[model samples]
Target: MAVKKIGIIMNGVTGRMGTNQHLVRSIVAIRQQGGVVLSNGDLIMPDPILVGRNEDKLQALAEKHGIERWSTNLEQCLADPHNVIYFDSQTTVRRAEAIRKAIKAGKHIYCEKPTATSLEESLELAQLAYEAGVKTGVVQDKLFLPGLLKLKRLIDSGFFGKILSVRMEFGYWVFEGDWQAGQRPSWNYRKEDGGGIIVDMFAHWRYVLDNLFGNVKSVSCLGVTHIPKRLDEQGHPYACTADDAAYATFELEGDIVVQANSSWAVRVNREDLLTIQVDGTEGSAVAGLRDCKVQHRVNTPKPVWNPDIENPFNFSEQWQTVPDNQNFDNGFKVQWELFLKHVVTDEPFIWNLLEGAKGTQLAELAIQSWDERRWIAVPELSLGVKQSDAVEASK
Candidate 1:
C-alpha cells in the first residue's frame, strides 16, 4: 500500500516548542524514518505547512527544514482541502480564535495545553470541535517521562499500598531573557499575555495528578509575584505583571492531599527539575524527572530526640534507588507519535480538548482560589452531549 500523506497546517512553527519539538524532532524525524508504519503495513506521512504571522521567520524555518510549504495566512491554508490537520503551539491568548477558525474550515485539531486563556474559552473550543465533528487533542506529555512512567508502574503494582499524601517541588531560576538570556519566553511573566506560574504549571499538575495519583477534588492556593520587575526579550526593563510563584494544595476525592510548589524565581537545589514525593501506609517513594527511589516498611528507620540534646533522624538513608527497567522517548515526541497514530488510525485518544479544558479549569480555579482566599471545587467538564454518545451516534 502507498503512504497516505496527511497534510498538517502547523501554526506557530517559528516559536520555541514549534521549532524544536513539533517540526524538527517529530515531523522531520518521522519523515527521515520513512514515515509512520501502520499495523496494516501502510505508512502515514505528515506533510507539514509552516503557518504563522511572521513571514520572514516562517520562510527561514521552512528553508531550515527543507519544507516547501510556508504561509503567514492561516485561513488560506485552512481552506485548502488537503490540509486535514490543524496543529497549534501559539500563545494561550491566540489558541481559541485560531482553533475556531480551523474548525470552521472543518479540520481536525491538536494543540498545546491550557487550550485558551480562560476556562470558559477552553470549554467553548472543546464543544465547538465536537459540534464540528473534528478530532481534537491536547498535549499531555508528562505521562511519557521515563521516571514518571516508572512511578506509574510502581503505583499500578501497589508498591505503595493505601496511599497517604504526595508532595511535589518543581522549579528553576529562570534568568530574565533580557540581561541573562533566560530559558523561557519573556511574555511568560506578563498577565496580559496569559503568563503566570500557576496557570502554566497547574495545568500540568491537573493531568499528572489524575493520571498518576487520583482525581483532584478541590484546591487552595496562594500565588505571588516574587519578582516585580524583569527584563524582556530585548535588553530593557519591564514590570512583571504576573505571579512568579505558587504554593497550592489539592484535596483528592479519597482523602488524599497533594501539595505542590511551582516557581520561576527559586534557585535550584533539588533532586531534579521536578520531584514528587509519595507516602503510603506500606511504603514511600520519591520520583524525580529521571530517577525514582523507594522506601519500604522493612527498611523503616527510627530516631529519638531529647530536650537537652540534638535529634538525629537519618531516614533519608533508608531509601533505595529504583532500577530503570525500560527506556522511554522524549515526552513531547512520545505524545506526537500518539497524535499521529490517532490521526491515521482513528484510535481513541482520551487526552482531547475536553481534557485540556479540565486542566484549564484547574488553572483558572487555582487563580480564583488565590484571589478569593478560599478553596475552589472544579466543576465537571461537559462536552455538549457526552463524547462517547456523540462518537457512537456518528458511527
Candidate 2:
C-alpha cells in the first residue's frame, strides 16, 4: 500500500492525439483508477504537468482535467528534478529536438513514433539515451489493440498453422476542407512539416509486422500525392507536397509476404478504418480494430472460377467470429500503464528507442524505395554502432 507519485512532464499535449490518447484516456484514466498497482503492492501514480506553447490552452486543459500543475515553459518544467519522465506528442519535425533536450535534462523519454525524420537522427537519439542510461520508449499502440491481440493469441495457439501472408487495408476519405474541414491536421499533407502517409504509417507497420509475424527483410513501395490541392485550417487553399497515399509490399524473415495499402483519399468499404487479413496453410483470419473473424482450412468452401455462370457461394458466411473472451482496455491506456510500471519498478520494457529507430529506418527506406523504384533491404539496426558504421553495415 505504498503510493509513489511519479511526476511526468507532458509536452505538446494540447494537440489532438496528445490530449485525447496520452492525457485523457491514459494518464487521467489511470489516476481515476487509483494508479497502477505493482506486484510488490506499491501504487505508482502519474502526476502530469501539462506543458504547451500556449498558456491559455495549457491552463484550460489543466483546469478541465482537475490537474494541479500546468506550464507554458518547457525548460522550466524540465529543470525540476521531481519530473522524472518527459513525454512528447508534438509535430514530427519538432520531436527529435525536444526529446534531445529532455534526455540532456536527465529524464526518461516516451513519445509517439517515427521518433525522428531520418534514420541517422533516430539512431543517434537511441545511442544518446543508451549512453545516458535513461529509460526510453515509443508508442506502438496498435500492438495492444483487441483485434491484433486476438490475432496474436491465434498465432500463439497455432490457429493459423504455417503462417503465409498478410494483407492490410487501412484508410478513410478525409474531407478537403473546402466544404468540410479535414479530419486530420493541415500539416499532415505538407512535406516541409514532416508530414506524409508513408512516414506516419510505415512506422506502425514495421513494428506490427516485426512483432506479429516476422522481421521485415525488404520492402517495395509506391507513393502518391493523390489530393494535390487542399484547404488549410483557415479555409485557405494550399498545394500538398507530401504523399497522401502509399502502396507497399514487404518480405518477412519467414518468407512471408505483406502488402499494405494506406491512404487518406480512399473511402472506407471494409470492417473498420484498418483491417488486416492473414492467410496461412491451415487457416485465415481478417481482423479489424475490435473484431476478428477466422476460417480454418477445413471450414473453407471451394469456389471454382466461372466467367459465364452467376456465383452462388456465400463467401462471407464461411468465417466464424472470434469471441471476446477477455475484456480489453483502451490500447493507449494499456501501453501507458505498462510504461508507468516500467518507470517505477525496473520492469522489462522491450519497446525502447532502438525499436523506434528501426521504425524510422523502415519509413526512410520505404520512401527511398518508392523514389528509386526498387526494393530496399531492411538491415538490422545496432545501438552500439556509430552512424558511419551503421551506414557501412547496411551496405
Candidate 3:
C-alpha cells in the first residue's frame, strides 16, 4: 500500500474553536490514527502547518501537538505549492479577504461557517472558487452530531410520519465578564467584528432545517441585545452592539413551521444546552445535544382537563429514551475526514461553497425580516455550476 501526504495550511487555529475542534479533536486526531485509509488500501496523511498572527502562540501550539511546521507569514504559506489546501478559522470579518488571497494562490479551500458577513460577498466567494476550479467546502458540523444523527435515523425510518412542526431551543447564559469571564470571545458581542447570534447561529439553523425538514420558504425574526455592556478579554468595558439573542420563525416547503430561539443570555433549564422538538402525525421527539427521547401516538398518555382537581400525569416520564446502538465520533473530525477524502480521491462532497452561500443568504434575510418587522421570502439561489455537476467536473 502506498501513502500520500497532503499539506494543509491551517490559519487562525490558535483560537478556541479552531484549536479545540478543528485542530486538536479533528486533524491531530486523524494524524494520530495513522491518517485516513482509502478504498484501495492507500493512506492519505495530513501534514498541517499552523499559521497565525502570533509567532509564540503558533510555535507553542505546534510544539504541543508534536508538529514541526509553524508559520506567522500567511502569504508565504499560501505561496508554497506544496500546501495544496488552505483552511481558515479566522474572525468572521477577516475570513473573506484571506480566502480570496488563498483562491488567488490556486489552493483548495475549506473553512468554518457563515463564510462571509453578507450574502453578496458569500456568493462572490463561491463564484470565485467555482471559476478557479478549486475544491471548496464550508463547515456544517451540527448535522453530524450524535443527537441529530439519531433524529435523522428516526426521520428516515418513518418514526415521525408526516412531520408538522419543529421547535429548537438553543442557548446558554454567557457571563458579561464584569465579575466572571465570558465563555465566548469578546468579539462575539461586537457588531463591528461581525458578531451577532443571527449571523453566527442562523447560518447553522438554515442548513439544519433545509437538510432535515425541507427547504425554507419564508422567515420572520426578532433580534435583541439583552446585555447592553460587557467586559472584554482585557477586562475593559465595551458596549454590546450585536444581537445576543434571536427568536425566528420559518415556513418550510411542506407547510412545516419551525421556531428557533437562539440566545447567549438565557439560562439553561432543559436536558442540554440545545434541544430540538419535532412533532408529527405519528409521534414526537425531543433531541438534545447527545440524547433523544420520543413519545409515539400509541404510547402517549391522555389526560383530562381539570382546573379544580389535582393533575396526576407525569409529563416527562411518558417519553422513551433512544438507545445508543452505534458508536459516534466527533462531528468536526467526521467532516474533516470526508473533506480530506474529497480532496485526494475526488469523492463527492455536497456541502460546497454554494451551500455555504445559501446559509449566508438565510441569515441575511432573517436579519432583514427582523429589521423590517415582516416576513421575508427566501428565493432559491442560482449557482453557475450545479454542485453535483461540479463534482463530476472535478472527476
Kindly give the number of clashing pairs for every candidate. Answer: 0, 0, 0
Better of 1 and 3 by TM-score: 3
- Cα lDDT, all candidates: 0.87, 0.93, 0.92
Q: 315-386, model 2: which lDDT tens digit per residue?
A: 888899999999999999999888888888879889999999888888888898998999989899987778
**lDDT against true structure, model 1:** 0.87
Residue-by-residue lDDT tens digits, candidate 3, 285-328:
99988899999999988888998988788899989999879999
Ranking by TM-score: 2, 3, 1
Off by over 4 Å in 1: 177-179, 306-317, 385-395
Candidate with best TM-score = 2
In terms of lDDT, model 2 sits at 0.93
Which candidate would rank higher by TM-score, 1 or 2? 2
For all predicted structures, in order, the TM-scores are 0.93, 0.98, 0.96
Candidate 1 residue lDDT tens string, 38-152: 8889998889999989899989889988898999888899999999999999988888899999999999999997899876678778998888999998988888887798899
Q: Which model is ahead, 1 or 3, in terms of lDDT?
A: 3
Candidate with the greatest lDDT versus the true structure: 2
Query: How displaced is residue 120 in candidate 2, in Å?
Result: 0.6
Pairs that clash in candidate 2: none
